[model samples]
Target: MKLHCEVEVVSRHLPTLGLRNRGKGARAVVSLCQPRPPARGEQAGPHSACLLVSTMKDKRGTRYEQLKENIEQFFTKFVDEGKATVRLKEPPVDICLSKANSGSLKGFLSAMRLAHRGCDINTSLSTLTPVKTSEFEKFKTKMVITCKKEYPLGKNFPYSLEHLQTSYCGLIRVDMRMLCLKNLVKLDLSHNHIKKLPATIGDLIQLQELDLSDNHLESFSVAFCQSTLQKSLRRLDLSKNKIKALPVQFCQLQELTDLKIDDNDLIQLPFKIGQLKNLRFLSAARNKLPVLPSEFKNLSLEYLDLFGNTFEQPKALPVIKLQVPLSLLELSARTILFNRIPYAFHIIPFHLCQDLDTAKTCVCGRFCLKSFIQGTATMNLHSVAHTVVLVDNMGGTEAPITSYFCSLVCYINSSDMFK
Candidate 1:
């Protein structure tokens, strides 16, 4: 199952300084660490030779001393490598590795003080287990619990309270402002309770794909249209939302190739949408769009789906005077239809009723023509096969082929014309 985790950071200290100095407020750094489980073969049975040895710790001193020794041993090389060293303040008792005998929680609490002062322990943390201590709450990052503890986190397990001084701290919420996620390349806050995103989100210069689907996003972050996003963004999924209209900023996605806005409250698309030169696939299915702009005719697009839209009927095209030699001009579709007229003769029935702006051309061959008649142009034949071959002083430099039977001609060849 895919999950969307929204982590919110609440700054406990709010200073009156301007944006410049305000960033300097002291704060606790919170980090969430998910533990790694031991490998399958690492388990020991009663017959195992390693289990035969008896291990005991004499209570000559506090467990804190043991934790300090363990941390120091783990980070010796890190200090030599110039990384932060571990420094123990209140060391913990014995750290038991046996599944039956758990380690002392208080001893683990003191071990954190040596995090970056004396050893590589911080970087070598293959797995981190928090100790049960009131002071441990000072760490701000929300702890994503991956391991199930045999016992609860003490008396304050569920509704615990701790007093710590920091610039940011707390549980996640729906509306967050200026969340600095500059390093994020792809983000999916889908199916979340998030209500709003700050306009400064465009500050993330490296973002390539963002999925805000299935949210209560009544509005959009205009910062998305910033120049930084316009150049690199490729995919944007905003389906299942309450958005009603496409903002003009949407046109700024010049590099976008796939755009999905299906299952929304949108009534119309932004007029500048056709300005996307690299658009390959566009899905506006299940929308309330009455009609698509004629500008779509100018697109070199190959695939388009307008299923489940409010377009009661197909749109009509303005009668255009064919100017270019449309013979070489290819209006491509997966299939072609020759309407009420069968594929018996060269004269093909045009589906002018479907999309008139497209000048459907015929392939001067056999197999291609057979498929054109039997396969392509199957759905809504009336809309796709009824093409009209116009005869005039337009594309063909040869004088317009005029004849009383011109309109009656079944197959309008490249050299022929039909007005």
Candidate 2:
């Protein structure tokens, strides 16, 4: 039986003295076999089987260690993930064999245990041999394809794949096979012709960076905003798309740090955009945004760019739409938000849940829905960012930001800002 993997041999007898290959391990083939018959006039050895370790480097010469004499204790140690160590006692010195690839390591340990017990291994030879490499392993972890011809012909991607890029591939839709890559961390489908993304794209729970820029995506899916991606996604690029609006659930991705949605048809960002506390870089240039969201003032960014956007001028007076007595819907929504109650499609009507999620937040850190006053105020971009770009050719650094108030008293308290 043979196992192929990296190996490192350490001697416990001489701790200070360095062996031929000390710290760095080498690729090797470890095997177990029956002891050869004694030669003419040679005394027979007591062992029924033997273990051998052979290095793979031919130029460095083969190194063999036979474990037949003075064999004491044999046991395995789980050093770490994909790694194990086997230790054998030989009177004066202790031999330690360490390697990686847990599958191979487990098989080797099983064979070694059987050999030490003087019993024949009942396992098949194919099971004992090293695993053959799969076609998917050829790409290692990162795979990039710039054109259709470069894309691999396969129904599924390797689960080991972490980063995959298919830019300029002219793909009209996301490959369904890629949704199975749960271990994926980054996926770049930029410069493609994709008109929409599959909801299953959110199944990649490990994904961190997603680039769908330069596509024909008309709108971001609400399903995607409610997926597990909200917890994992850190960087997103939707630049040069046809996306007109983003779902309010998009703000739940608090892990986001970098966002680029430049050159889109976005009329307004999500109302709860300030929920992304980690955001540092933002670029929404060339959009059709009329005014920023009420929560836009909550963000603290390192870089801000709103150039080429047609922002509306601040209004002279706030629009008063407050209800004399808060409606039942507004009161219930406020209760849900204040109590942090978890709501989903399974718990209530989908539209009701969506309305609650998209509810507006007042300047005094309270939520409002249907019974709030709407107002707009001019805000200097430099107040939120360390570096700011001119919003237009007029060298304007200020843009109109919307605000909401849950009550008449709240609106009166913030009325000075509209003057």
Candidate 3:
């Protein structure tokens, strides 16, 4: 195979380069005056890749029109996308390509080899835009796909999938039976143009994590929340979209631990969101939320990102540091309140909803620890799980030592410290 390329020398430093010996100084620039395919097994993008380089000439230093297109039209198949300029450093003019067509890398490689009729052209393959990524090479299925094919909801997808992440593909749909990847655990479809998922998505009963961020989806299908996907789905991301309201079925995702709805136009979240008893992380940043639902006080959320919202800082909301990951009260319960004011925020599950004066016992009914620090005697809780309750002002004057320590060691240590 030969490359229909043009090579011309435009520069020569005979003295510095040691022309007598030849090839002895700086790197000699080799200009690629025509598009060239990447090395064997080297992947190329759907778009044409153009590479430009300076021409290193001999003693004569001849130049040609300062012209030559170094574009590798390796991709034999392409559909109409739009006209866009692909610039290169040395190759002054840009080399455009056929519209994007999704296809098989193996086939593309075979076609590229067939295109070359003569000598090879040397250039970096970085300038090419990959339509399908190297992730394709990892496929175990025996099917061969090509770029000229439009994706249909057919049954030709890979099988026995566990993880799949396809991003920036402008994808609109996928094969339905591929959802038959029952063992699939994680699937990321970020940065695509998909608007809706097929009902067959439920076939992925074992899918635990799904990322559909940066898409055109306005809402989800009813089957998504009602199907087996609801039982095993643990994480979901719906960020950067035009979704205004979530379907009521979303509340059925009881096993969901993390939910990201950032950068959307959501005015409010589903009222039944508190039903997710296991939810730990929730990010609703950059939305139009004015006030949170009262049911929100029921769930124990460790990390909540509500910045860039319309709601004012609620006094009942505990102050949260954006940089620090929030831990349960037992881990960060460093403050003790007794006959003194507690200016710093604290996380505790002392049942603020109940009549504090009548609720003589701690939320967990565990023993409390009393200690002396700074010449002041104070009582603190040794360790207890968090109860999602927020209070604005907890004056020390109203507090009384009435709970028991979780362990005898805590009691003895506090008693020894006080003594």
TM-score of each: 0.37, 0.71, 0.40
lDDT of 3 by residue, 99-162 (tens): 1112222332333333242323343332222223232333332232222253334444454346
Predicted structure with the largest TM-score when compared to the true one:
2
Candidate 1 lDDT over 50-139, as tens digits, reads: 000111121111112223233433233322111222333234211222101012212222234343233323322322333323423432
TM-score of structure candidate 2: 0.71
Q: Is candidate 2 or candidate 3 better by TM-score?
A: 2
**Reference-based lDDT, residue 235, model 3:** 97
Off by over 4 Å in 2: 1-139, 154-158, 344-349, 415-418
lDDT, model 2, position 413: 86
Compute the lDDT of residue 416 as modeled in candidate 2. Answer: 46
lDDT for model 1 comes to 0.39
What does candidate 3 score on TM?
0.40
The lDDT of each candidate is 0.39, 0.76, 0.47
Q: What is the lDDT of candidate 2?
A: 0.76
